[model samples]
Each structure stands twice: as C-alpha cells, then as structure tokens.
Target: MSRTGIATGPNALRGIVMMCLGMACLAINDAFAKYLTDVYSPVQILFLRNLIALPFAVIIAVRLGGWDAMRTRRPGLHLLRGTLWLAAATLFFTGLRYLGLAEATVLIFAAPVIITGISALFLGETVGWRRWSAVLVGLVGVIVVVRPGGDAFQAASLFPLATAFLYAILMISSRWVPAEESLWTTMVFQVLAAGALAGLASLWFWTPVALSDLWLFIGIALAGTLGMTLITEAFRFSEAAVVAPFDYTALIWATLLGYLIWNETPDAMTWLGAAIIIGSGIFIILREARPG
Candidate 1:
C-alpha cells in the first residue's frame, strides 16, 4: 500500500489480477456445485467439498510456517464463521437448483452492501449517509430481481437473499476476531466446522454420488480453495476499496458459463438489477475511498 493507503503501481495491478482470478475461480466452484445439485443434497455436496478441501488447506497451513502460523486464540469465532459458511453454501446451492447462475450470483452480490449496513447498525461503525443510501439502492435492485409477486418470482430467490445476509454476518463476525489471529487458523477451522456440521447433516440426507461425479466434487474443492487463496492475497496486496469493484467480474463468468453449459440466460430485468447493484457497489467504493 502507498502512503495514501491505496495500492499503487504494480501492487494495484497485482490486486486487480488476483481479485479477478479469484472471482473466476469462485464462479467455477459454484458451477460445479450447481451441476451436482441435480443428483445430490446440498449438504452431501458440501460435506464432500469440505472433505476434499481440508487436506490441502491443512497443507497450506503447515507450510505457512509449520504449526506456528496455524495457531488461533479464537476457535469459537472461527466455528461461528464456519457455521455461517456451511449455511450459506447449502442455501446458495439450493438456490442454484432452481435459479440460473447469473441470477443467483447477482442476488448474492449484495453481500458487501449488506455488510456495510450491518456494520453501521450493529457494529457501531461510523458509516455516513451516502453509503446508507447506496445500501438502499442496492436493495431495490435486489427487489427488482426478486420481483416478489411477479410470475418470475420463486421461493428459491430467498435462498440467495439469505445467503447475502448470512455472508454479511460472517464478514462482520470476522471483525471480532483479534488482528493477531492467523488467517490460516481461521481458514482451517472454518473448513473443519463446515465439515463437522455438514457431516452430521449428511447422515440424514445422504445420497450416493456416482464415480463420474467424484471428479466434479474435486473440481469444486480445488476451485474454491484457489478462490479463497487469491482473494486473501488480493486484500493483502491492495486496499479493499481498490479491488472490490473487480469482484463484480463474477457475474460475467457466471453468465457465460451458465449459457455455455446449462443453456441458461438471464432476462433484461436480471441485467438491470445487476447493473444497479454493481453501480451501487462502485459508489460505495468511491465513498469509502474519499478521505474523511
């Protein structure tokens, strides 16, 4: 970061690249999970996804500095985060079962806006009026996409809304963890938390996944891990406000992949909602970047 607290020069470019690649990786992970939702419970899929990702996360933790860098004083917070993660994943996958990739992603894209509102209301963060207005505008965009009583409406739309809310809560909860806490420890614990919870849920809803689909689960795991790592690196390299706008690139990936693989295309209203939400996000970034 430069003296102005923004990523400058090559650091800015690196952050942009990391954030863009991270969004693409996450999109790929979601696509793989969407494909599997056709034949498996979200819990079952989440269980395997966590299981597959665990060893790699542990390996990364170990390599981050062999046991020392993997320590955390906040196990309870990590478990809470993991539970939120598990819920968000299961709800999102459930939404995917009925909604197109772009539509679902657009709704989930409200997470950051929700996070700001949460911080101001509950965390005592001094969010100004401009950011609050953007949150409302972003919510209107969400309502347009959801279309409550319209023929396009479905109960499944609530899943992503819930996901955005839960995700915001998850992010806010992270603030409670001490700054000295190891991210690797948080990462590993959350995965284990999801694994433990999902494993229990699987006992009741387990469905046998075929040998053919095993590869898809592994792909989900790998893509998700790559996304998480890149996103972490992105924040390390640049200011959150500087790189956050780039995260919107996930919509493009979701739309393209949905059309190519599943023959799904979002309508004009979806695009309109997406544009509104994205514009609000950009505005929030601009507001935050302005020096107080």
Candidate 2:
C-alpha cells in the first residue's frame, strides 16, 4: 500500500484489486438498500443515509477549505443537479423493490451509453457512426435483459432504466458545474437535496422501524459513505477510461451478494444479457481510447 493508504501501481493487478473492492462496497450498499426497501420508504432511506453523512461532509469541507469551501457560483445548477440526484435515487430504490440488485445495477450502467447520445445531441459533440452503432447494440442488450414482451420481464425494470437517464443528466450537469466549486460543496448540496426530497416523498408510506432494522440503517450509512468515497477517489487516481469499465465489476459483486445474502441466482438469460451489455460497454470505452 502507498502512504496515502490506497495502493499505487501501473499494473493491472493493483487496479483490479481497487476496482473489485470499490464495486463490492457499492454492491453491499445496494444490498442493504434493497433489504431496507421492504420496510423503509425511499425517502426514509435517503434521509437516514445522508443525515449520517451530512455532518461528515461539512467537516470535510471545513477541514479542506474552511467556510468558503461551501461556496458555489451557481445556486441554480446546484438545485438542478440535486434534483437529478434525487430523482435517480428515488427511482433506483423504488425499482429495487421489484427487481433484483444485480439486474438493477446492470440496467443503471446503461447511463454512460445514454450519455454518449445525450452529449451528441445537446453538447454538439461528435459521436461517429461507429459509436452510435455501439450505442444501439448496447440498447439491444438492455432489451434482452428487460425482455419487455416476455413473461420474465417485470414492469419495475423500466424504473432502473429511466433512472439511468436521470443519472446521465446528473453526470452531464456535474461535468458542466464550475471547476472552482469544491467537492464538499457538491457533496453537501447533493446529500441535503436528496435527503430532504426523499424524506418528504416517503411520508406517504412511512413505516415504523424496528430496533434490528435500525442496526441495518447504520450499516447502510457507513457502507454507502465508504463506497462513495472509494468511487470518488477512484476517479481521482485513475483516468476515467481506466476506471469507467471497472464499474462492470459491480455485476460480479452483486451476483455474489445476491447468492449469499438473498439466495437469488440469476437465470442463464440474465447472465448472457449482462455479458453482452458489459462487453459492448467495454467496446465503447475502447473505441474512445483509440486514436481518431
């Protein structure tokens, strides 16, 4: 390990370790969220998760940049981004109530693929025919996974796919947010906005929490914090291209967790569809990496 506590190496081995651990943490977060879904509303989960994290976000900002660290040049953008984040979180957890964790995770990964098209349309960025073709193939993989016309398909699967689009918008806004804005500012706005919105929305179907479920709530908060911290650092240390495809590692972690914790084994078709989505996603990444 390096002095920073994260390992340092140009080798794929170390990268794989970091990537797998990061994804495992994220999968654990999702698993906890799914379990809580049976009892808690999306807003409740969001409130508790961020309430546990909000103080730390403030502390981090103060430690790193003092009071000024929380400053933002664009309140409107912050509100807009927080809305997207809230929408993504709500839809994703709502989807979880009906879909398996692994299935939902794969569908959400479609966000980046959608982002390519969004950028082409809105940002005037050029997406060549080749990349556009890859996007179509990726959508086909999604259709296979969702299998809309088939009995295997659940209506809830669409929620995750829709959330993916919201996430893409969140990411696009993040890309445009002023660079001078501190991470603390961004984190604060996101947690506060999502937490408050979810809490209010959950009022319609709120349930009393048992003492035991409270324990799980603690785990959700801690694990979520850890997972998001790792993901943020992953972006800092590695190139986006290098770290992006590593997100597919979530499928592996979700599969294992689904088996061990929930005993939910995805059928053959799910695995096959996951493989196609991942393979096509990697192909898109590689295409971006190559010289024009």
lDDT for model 2, please.
Answer: 0.80
lDDT of 2 by residue, 1-292 (tens): 4443334367434455566677888788889989999888887887888878777777766775678777878878877887788788878989989888889988987887888889899899899998898888888888889998899989999999999999988888888778887776787778777777667776886788889888788788777766766666666666556666888989988888888888888888877778777877887776776655
Give residue 254's error in model 1 in angstroms: 0.3
Give lDDT tens digits, candidate 1, residues 1-292.
Answer: 5665666778878998999999999999999989999999999999999999999999987887478657778778888899999999999999999999999999998998998888888778898888999999999999899999999898999999999999989988887878876777788889999999999999999997899999999999999988988988898888888888999999999999999999999999999999999999889876888787
Candidate 2 has its poorest 10 consecutive residues by lDDT at 3-12
Provide the clashing-pair count of each candidate structure.
Answer: 0, 1
TM-score of 1: 0.95
Model 2, C-alpha of 70: deviation from truth (Å): 2.0
Per-model RMSD to reference: 1.7, 4.1
